[model samples]
Target: MNRDPLPPLTAFPPVPFDAPGRTSPVAGAPTLSQLGDAARAMVPYLREQARNTELERRVSQKSTDMFREAGFFKLMQPARFGGYEYGFTAFIEIISELARGCASSAWGCSLGAIHQWAVSTFPEQAQQDVWGENPYAIMCGSYAPAGKAEKVDGGYTVQGEWHWASNVDNSEWALLGVVFPPNEDGTSPGAGFVLVPRKDWRIEDNWHVVGQAGTGSKTVAIDQPVFVPAHRRLTFAEASSNNPPGASVNTNPIYRIPFLSAVPVCLASPMLGNAQGAIEVFEELCGSRVTRGAVAGGGNRLSQFFPVQSRLAEAYASVDAARLLLYRDTTEVEKMAASHTIIDVPTRIRNRRDHAFSTRLCHQAVEGLFSSVGGAGLSLDQPLQRMWRDANMMARHISLNWDAVSSMVGQYHLGLEPKGQY
Candidate 1:
């Protein structure tokens, strides 16, 4: 099939970065450092837009356009589709930097970008269906098996309401999760995703929340059954096996990575940024902040207090530790993929363990920082309070939740069959 040519690489607007050695030879292709610098450059603008984003309950179209122009969304997309095909480590750095400005915006961007890689795991026809005409089209997803699919002649009839599809407002398609019924032999195909275009599904506005409100993680519904071709479906088994159908075409080591080995990083990276941002805000405030003696201390600088100093150190340590774990696991997996090595179960589970643990560390970092902020940090105008709320929300995700992942890890170590996704 003849597809329309993509826009010239030079058509992407250049993002201003003052740092030296940040340029890329390829017009639209961004080096990791350049991408990180671009994300850092957007911080002030994102912070300025933070409150309004929360109030509006969605990342502004302007912000989305800026991200697209910067080439962040193409980081993990297949090179065939004009993506940079960067690894998960690069994704971690860019997303964490964005989260330092606004967790919700970073999250919306994270999901949007990650789905590009996810979609690349489907059959070649499915990949073409999505990006053939519009290579820039992005997808939003709801991964729980909340939808039903009935097998038909050439495809399946799908219907359900998928909840918490982040960045749905800006997406052209959705990956809705569904489970296929067992075959005549009673062998089950298990849970998987079905690709549906925006025309087939409707977005429901119901994303009210105290944290990460700007993400606009709403519900996607198909009231009537929609026919989804078989090629558009990717089973959990195929994706986890690290040799999905798209691997034959994309051939990128990134696409060969097991789904659980790295995808959870998408959930953890935002919290990592939230905590780091909180630490920065707290340190800046402590430098000149003098305590008012409502009870005892009046003139002492907040930074002078032993407790405040300790808290700052603790927060920094926690965030640093989380980043290292995330980077270590992600990079290791990428290297394994590059070597065409089979990612063993132990390695995969260990990565999952780090994903949850790293998120917990980030959450703790923000919590400790928020604790010292006292009444001053409680104000709605303060970004610390928002970061605290956002970190809490990020940790609550099922994939990043400490209790769930820890239990799964424990089950494996104890020789019992692990029950959770890995």
Candidate 2:
């Protein structure tokens, strides 16, 4: 598995995409293709580390450093902070490639990287609060609106135990979801995110799980009330709208798109990679696997069996179909954002629908492959079994859950008000 070494962090220029007053590419920015190649080059090493990553129940710091050095975390960060400011489409490609080697590592990377973009949607001061001194800072988030925020003089007092803050171990800051109190008029409460530095909260090591264990998705607890400045808070209404506060400063069209329209792709991309990786493993195994049959007189090549062949074909097709849906929807959203087109409800729901459906396809592909592997895949040593478990866990995510997203899509089509997150 010899391959070229990863490109150095210096190889990525401060601004890959065009900035506000600039028309030319940065002097030394690496092309998107180079970034993709770098991700591919790390696959073998990531695959070798998969077992240990799972055993430790967290992505290794070495892997996290590798991602930073390769400039993956800067892909969606604001160019002002020495980031590439690349779009979600590039994110999907890179994450999927990484997932082919290790789903958990890929999941950690995916969330960490996407939060860079998420942070960019906050006010400029909040963005600076995060990347002011540390341009390389990355954040992990729990978007469940589980925390309570009390309005104060210049900020809000926030406290709660937020669950499933993925990649918390490797993150320097956290984007915690909080529910603001009712308005003066006694309107409904508003739900949103408040940025809190790692010092303000504590990580409870309770992320023991059967799948995606390497993600380090533990609980973030603020036992006592912590004051979060108003500038660091982003309301859901503002974030879901086309124009968020960050849009005023960043001015990149990428920052102007609705939050939900593209964020879920972060969740789907790793599952897409997991399915693709599983298929590759299945192909390799079928080539050398020989069935030990008692009644059928053993020693038959597994590839020769029609059922195995059919399952392989089906898995491949499912993965391909899933990839198509993901790319098509992501590309459309990115294009719309670039053109300054408002991402209307129909388009938003369509993207959400594709996100869940794509992961569902990936789950089906992994399940089919796992079912065909028989007793061999049950071993802890087998990557196929891990892929199966990881894919199942990803599909169960609320954002990518078929039942949850599909029902929202159905409600929109039926002219009833949709009831779930967009």
Over 4 Å off, model 2: 1-27, 185-189
Pull out the clashing pairs in model 1. Answer: none
lDDT score for residue 396 of model 2: 99
Tens digits of per-residue lDDT, candidate 2, 362-387, equal 89989988888788789998899999
**Candidate 2 residue pairs in backbone clash:** none
Score candidate 1 by lDDT.
0.88
Predicted structure 1, TM vs. truth: 0.93
